[model samples]
Target: MSTSGRSRAAGPDETPAIGRPRDANRDVAILDATLLLLTEVGYDQLSMESIAARAGVAKTTIYRRYRDKVALVAAAVEYRSQSSPPAVGPGGLRGNLLTLVQWLAEQIAEQEIGLLGALFAGMRSDPGLAAEMRRILRRDEAAMTDQPLREAVKRGERLAPHAAELFAEVAPAVIVHRIVVAGETCDERFVEHLVDDILLPLLRGHPNKPARTERGTGSKGTRS
Candidate 1:
């Protein structure tokens, strides 16, 4: 979660003028500063001037890289997301999902509650930020589940229609609700319950049961 002293090359969209490369160290500094300020003061109170001062860069430097706070914050969020550990597990649908849920829980646990609250509030108040956040989440959801679902199909397991879309909403929603709204811990037991009791049932049509079909059978199937 801490991005201090970490540097990455600027993405294609962030490229600077010819022969004038963007400083990777400065990019890290600015993103780190933005995240820190966001946690402390929330999006409404954060200012470009404050970020520049905190990052030890000129205001124009930030403006040159990002058009405004919205773009800067989105970039910071994307950077943090990219920095997180990839969700990998043993080769099985259930095992992969368990790893994904655990990975998501760990990511959420690393964030400051104030930062979460700030983001929730900002989403309510700023349409642009909300859209950007949703887009980022959707992209991540696809990345996390694509392999597992595809592997399941290869194993002759039939997924309900729209299974990916349904799965994308369930685990994160429940985990975030438990931690952020119910103010409860998202421990191992909870993750297991969510996967075994809820998600598995929804996706596979029954707990611990694989959805398989006989050849040339016209059996009705469930949509995930």
Candidate 2:
């Protein structure tokens, strides 16, 4: 959940400028500063000056790299969410989903929930930030769900149409709703319940309603 210290190279849209290359050190510093400030003050209170002061760089330096705070904040969020692919379990779909849910729970734990809620609050007012959030989340959701389903298919399992979309929504929707609306943290147990009781059964195309299993029975639920 930590942001990488190595700065990314200029993106596709970056204009070719006839000058010294952008300083990688400054880029990391700026991003690091932005993340820290986000946790401290939330999104609305953040500004270019405060970020520059915290990062020990000039405001113009930040502007040269990012057009505005929305883009900068988006970049910071993307950086925070960077992680290796979720580990697939040997139990096929069920195992893979358990790993995926736990991984997401860990990521969510690292984030300051209030800070995230603040960002969500700004989504309506700032179309650019909202679009960026959607883009990143969609790309991430695809990666998270697609690989597991493909592996399951390889193992001779059947999958439902729209399964990927359905499974992808479960973790994020539940996690965010828990944090933002329900005012609860999604502990490991809740995440296990979500995967085993809800998501796994849905992907299996069972028509019967799910029954509540014993508290520690999630692992059992995955066993064939």
Candidate 3:
């Protein structure tokens, strides 16, 4: 449906509504209108007036659920994202992180460049939008420890002192940097390099060197 600016996705069957049940079909119609407008007009050009006209719902109906532009945009982003909790399992740090990164890659490749791209800029003027973006990023960052910590505690890995800061900051930071700053694509190989070369060493209390081979080298089993 929409992810507003967050990297979540909603299937066409989902609604952008919450807090109470709504006229199911009506909400879906409004969201369909929202997504269509987002794709066609971009976020800056999107307006409540356009949503009303597109949905055949009065502006009052739209306003009744969403108090302002920020709320409506957030709902649409969450809707399209089908925002679900991070996958949790005994796979520990590595497993949890892989799912998290894969989701980020997909969202950037699929949603951010299309219907939701403009939401990124909207954050400049809207604090709520900025918070949503941070919330989405933090979920992945915080997930690194759930199982890993449990396992480390069992084996008495001591949880290394700097580990907390590293997990919560570095992995997400690189991905964010690559996407938001360097404009690099987060392909599967890159994620693998990050995990094998970057994350594993940090977890083990080693330097943050992720092993790598250049573009033309033969594939090796080493990290990167």
lDDT of 3 by residue, 30-143 (tens): 777887887787767889999999999999877776776666776666666654435456655555556666665555555545654576666776687678656655553444
Q: Which candidate is the best by TM-score?
A: 1
**C-alpha lDDT of candidate 1 relative to the true structure:** 0.73
> Lowest lDDT 10-mer window, candidate 3?
1-10
Q: Rate the local accuracy (lDDT) of all candidates.
A: 0.73, 0.72, 0.63
Point out the higher-scoring one by lDDT: 1 or 3. 1
- Model 1 spans with C-alpha error above 4 angstroms: 1-13, 83-91, 182-184, 206-224
Kindly list the per-residue Cα lDDT of model 2 for residues 1-224, writing each as its tens digit: 22222225332234677678777888788888987897788777889999999999999888887888888887777666667556567766766877887777667667776667767876766888788778766677777777899899899877767888887666677776776677777765677678767886677675254524433453444321
- 2 against 3, candidate with superior TM-score: 2
Clashes of 1: 1
Clash counts for all predictions: 1, 0, 12
Write candidate 1's Cα lDDT for 42-94 as tens digits: 99999999999999999998987888788888788767654443445554776
* Candidates by lDDT, descending order: 1, 2, 3
